[model samples]
Target: MILYIAKRLSAGIVLAVLVTFLTFLLLSTSFQDVVRTILGPSATPETVRGMMAAKGWDRPVVVQYLDWLSHAVRGDFGVSVYTSLPVGPSVLQHLAVTLSIIIPALVLTGIIATLLGVWAASRGGAADRFAQGISLVGYLVPGLLLAIGLVVIFAVQLKWLPATGFTPLTEDPSAWLRSITIPVIVLMIGGIANMAAQVRGRMIDELRQDYVRTLRTRGISTRAIVFKHALRNAGSPALTVFSLEFIQMFGAALIIENVFALPGYGSYAFNASLQGDIPVILGITAFGVLLVVVVNLLTDLVNGWLNPKARVR
Candidate 1:
């Protein structure tokens, strides 16, 4: 297990480095004179050139990426060209806010999906059909449209929560919850849609296996057969589905955060992109790629642990 995990981890690191280099290369080469974008159509050539020289942007692209990579390795991601603030701190702050919204949504999605899937698989009745229908619709809906509809219903009409914005948990716990609730629900709906179906299908397949029938014939309770035996058998595929869904949730948060006016990593990076702020863009891109790679690696480790054959495969 240790060796398998180590192998996965090493692969993740290499992938992260490649992603970072490619992102850096593209952003650096494409957006020439971010200073002009920063200063807006007003800055003169002399001013722009002076500013670029001051910021060491006049250097060759390779030299710039190498320098940035070295600094990024030491936890300094340079300053945000958009905000004139330290890139690392700003991105970290935004990441914290984003996680506050994303984590609860993911946890709720998992718990609810698991329960719904298990119930639907075990029962297979009207409720199961309803769940299946809901999942199908949810999987098909665009996240942006869902977020908009939610904001209109919950935030605009009902006035139960703020329409869009972010509040730090440390500032006021209740306000923080109120702020994140809408975004959470939006992301949750999409996740639950696909995840429940995944769980239901896997559980159904597990329940149909011969071992399940053997356990049932031995007078094992349905609960034990489902939860203990069948559920464990179903878990390998479920883990894979859940991991991919979580990654999707992370990507969806980018758009959702922007729609909600939340100061998340996604929103920050997005706003920076409009202004062509390369450093901040690079920071967010590198961080997001690394996050996805790490998550995938962890999922592999978990899958390997659950079924040791996976490690060799």
Candidate 2:
């Protein structure tokens, strides 16, 4: 198990380096545009050259990436070109806001989707159709439209929740919950649909296996056969989908945050991209790559727990 974990960690490290390097390379290609945005298009060629030289923009991309990586290892992500503020702290703060909603959404999605999927698979007929219908509706609706409609009904018409803005959980837990509720729901809808469908399909497959018939003949309770043996076998694939849902949620956050006016990682990253804020963008990119690595590692661990044979692979 230790060896397996070490192998996974090493692979994650390599993946992080490759992802960040590629992102950095792509961003570096836009250096000229970034400089123009920073210095303004009206600036003279001499002034632009001076600014580029001052910022070490003329350096080779490899050298620049190495320098950034060294500082990143030391927890120094540099300052934002647009805001002139430290990138690490700002990125972390906004990320915290984003995670506040996303974490809850993900947990809820897993639990609810699993229950729905298992129920649907075990009790096919109306129950299966119901689950399929819900999943289909969630897939058909656009997240942005769903978010807007929710805000209109719950926040605007009924006044049951805040329409925009966020409150720190530490400052006001009730308000914080209210602030994140709609956004969480929006994210959850899409995630649950996709995850539940995958789980349902896997469960159905597991239930049809010859072992299921043997278990029934051997006097194992139907519930035990389904939930204990079948669910465990189905879990490995379900978990893979669940892990990917985290990344999907992160992408959806950009739209959800903008719609709800939450100060979150998505909005921060979006603004940074628009202004070509290299330091901030790179900081967030590194953070995102690190997050993906960690999530994948966790998923592998969970998969190993579900199926010991997976560890060797």
Candidate 3:
């Protein structure tokens, strides 16, 4: 297990490096000028050129990429063009906000979906059909639309929570929790539905296996067989779906963040792209790539541990 984990981690590091390099190359080659965007229309050409030179944009693309990479290795992510604050600190603050919502949402979604899936699989009638329908709605609905509908129902009309904006936990923990409730629910809706569907499918397949039938024939209680034997085997595929969903939640929460006006890395990335803030955009992209790689590696390790054949290989 340790060896498998180490191998997966090594592969993830390599993939992250490659992703960062490609993202840098693409952003650097784009026609947009970070300096011009930062300086705005009133700035003279000399000013813009000076700003470019100061940012070392005048250097070759490879040189700039190397410099940025080196700085990243040393924990320096440069300054944000919009705020002139060190990009590392800025992004970290936003990342924390994102995680505050994402982590809880992931946990809640996983637990709720797993239970729903298992229960539906065990029943196999109208309840199962209803669960399937719920999953379909979750999978088909656009995240932005869901977020808007949630806000309208819970925040605007019902006045149960804040419509948007994030409050720091340090400032007021209660208010912070209150503020994030809707966003977390909005974010988890699709994830829970998708996870439940995957779990239900896997559970059904596991129940059909010969081993399950053998257990049943041996006079084992249905609950015991399903919970102990069936669930353990069914978990492997569910873990795979969970890992993919986690990565998607991390990177694709941009639309939800926008809808909730939450200050997160997703919103920063979106704004950076619009402003053509090359450094900030590249920094966020690098972090996102690293996150994805790490999640994939973790998933691989978990899957390997759950399946002996994977560990043996």
Candidate 2's residue-wise lDDT over 1-313, tens digit each? Answer: 8998999999989988898889889988888878888787798888888888998888999999999999998999999987799999999999999999999999999999999999999999999999999999989998999999999999999999999999999999999999999999999999999999999999999999999999999999999999899999999999999999999998888998999999999999999988889999999988998898899999999999999999989
Candidate 2, residue 277: how far the Cα is off, in Å? 0.5
Query: Candidate 2 clashing pairs?
Result: none
Angstrom error of the Cα, residue 58, model 1: value is 3.8
Q: lDDT of model 2 at residue 7?
A: 100
lDDT-sorted candidate list, best first: 2, 3, 1
In candidate 2, clashing pairs total 0
Per-candidate Cα lDDT values, in order, are 0.84, 0.94, 0.84
Q: Per-residue error at 231 for model 2, in Å?
A: 0.4
Candidate 1 stretches greater than 4 Å from native: 38-53
Best by lDDT: 2
Candidate closest to the true structure, highest TM-score: 2
Comparing 1 and 2 by TM-score, which wins?
2
Give candidate 3's root-mean-square deviation (CA, Å).
Answer: 2.2
Worst lDDT window (10 residues) for model 1? 28-37
Listed per candidate, the RMSD to the true structure in angstroms reads 2.2, 1.3, 2.2
Q: TM-score of every model?
A: 0.91, 0.96, 0.91
